[model samples]
Target: MTITVGEIKYTNAFPFFYYVDRNKLLEKDCHFLIQTPATLNREMKAGRIQVGPISSFAYAENVDEFVLMPNLSVSANGPVGSIFLYTKRPLEELEGSRIALTTTSATSVHLLKILLKQYVEVNVTYDEMDPSFDEMMQDHDGCLLIGDEAIVTSWREEVETYRYDLGELWKEYTGTSMTFAVFAVRKDAIARQRAILEELYTAFVLSKEKNRKEQYASMIRHIQKGMGGTTAFWNHYFSNLVYDFHTQQQKGLLLFYEKAYEEGFLPKPIESIKIWGDVRTHHSSLM
Candidate 1:
């Protein structure tokens, strides 16, 4: 059966997904949908895409309909250079200031809220606006941005602002990796395409291993060409990102869910992550 898969259109996902085309078997069975995490989340929920990396918050919103893929995610231990809050005032000093959040985000928006309210203990108003740094900074004290836009903004020399990497901040607050997005599959689709899913997992792992073995200088050059970052910047960004959803990443995501739940961002508290994998191991993990 042909399975629909959502591919996150960001530099962080390249190591996990870039080499999928090398697997001829998967290329035939998988139909890929490339889009931003927010768009992918909506598509996955609508059943337009059977499996893909989606916003962690979106997974919680439709927890019953989906199960997470094993050993696959978009996460970082510290200083994920792609997500930043460029602020006018110092972070602690912005108690009553206004911040603009990117409307294109799902997980980062809630992550920022959890940090600002539960950790920072700030009483601030947030505006949901388009991801335009110049426009956002004009009217608000800070702007929470993610993906390529955040990276480009950080690289730009002209617009100087105090920038805080959300991943680093999350690590400081929780002492664990921040899992921004996860591979989520429709429960029904999992039952129908179990073999394909397993192969897909193998291919993804192989892709990640290959990426880690070398600098992939050509890929870096391509990224620099399109994104306008220095070769060193792109190299460091890719080298440090964590893509596997092991124990640490899982713990971080669970804590995030807990915080999101307490803040009333989710309808219910998620106790354990439901996963798509070996039945015995999945049950054991839940326990």
Candidate 2:
């Protein structure tokens, strides 16, 4: 079975996909489609690809069709450096302000909305545009940015702006971590591709273990060569993230879905999250 994998083309996602056992996939080729989170979300939803890390909000949109892979997610406890809101005014004063939401991610966009409406209690106008910091700032009071673009641009230090890290803010308001992306497989594809998917899932688990232990240094170095951040900075950045999706992460995700629904952004309330595996996690792996 030729399996198609959607890879989120972001520095924060590299650890989980970098060390896959491609040569061991039952002699079938593994095709990779590396793109932004929004694109992967669409591709997975359309069944064009078997599995990938999709925006958390996108998964909630079509939860019935996707079964989450065990213990795999792009999540963070606090201060995820890659998702930021650069504003000229304070959070309290941003009511009725035009905010530029990045088109590259659905989860971040919705997360921002949840934060603003539910937590901050401010209603702001949102405009979706490409993640261009300069152009976005021209017409909006603030702009939301995520993934590599936000990572590379240190808007907090370079400019005199009010910077908010969504992850940190979520923790402050909700008192829990936030999950941005999840690894999911189409529910229909489960019966046919079970073996291959199990192997792939194990490989991903091993990769996350190895990376979290000592392998991420190399990833950070490579990202530095291309993305241009100090090794220390990159280390600090990735340290804030958690790859394994366990009970806490699931609760956080459900809370997000709840907020999205309450804010009228999510279509319906999701009572529970569905995982492919029976257990919550394969918790320990070379940690």
lDDT of 1 by residue, 1-287 (tens): 77788888888887777666634654566678888898999999998898778998899999999988788888999988899998988889989999999987899999998898988888899999999999999989999999988987877789878999999999999898889989887888867877666666666766776777777566677677777777788888887788889999999999999999999999999999988767222111100
Candidate 2 lDDT tens digits, 161-202: 888999999999999989999998898877887666666677
Clashing pairs in 1: none
Clashing pairs in 2: none
Error of 2 at 224 (Å): 1.5
Instruction: List the candidate 1 regions with Cα displacement exceeding 4 Å.
Output: 22-29, 279-287
Model 2 residue 286 CA deviation in Å = 18
Off by over 4 Å in 2: 21-27, 155-157, 278-287
lDDT of each: 0.84, 0.85
Overall local distance difference test of candidate 1: 0.84
C-alpha positional error of residue 161 in candidate 2 after TM-score superposition, expressed in Å? 1.3
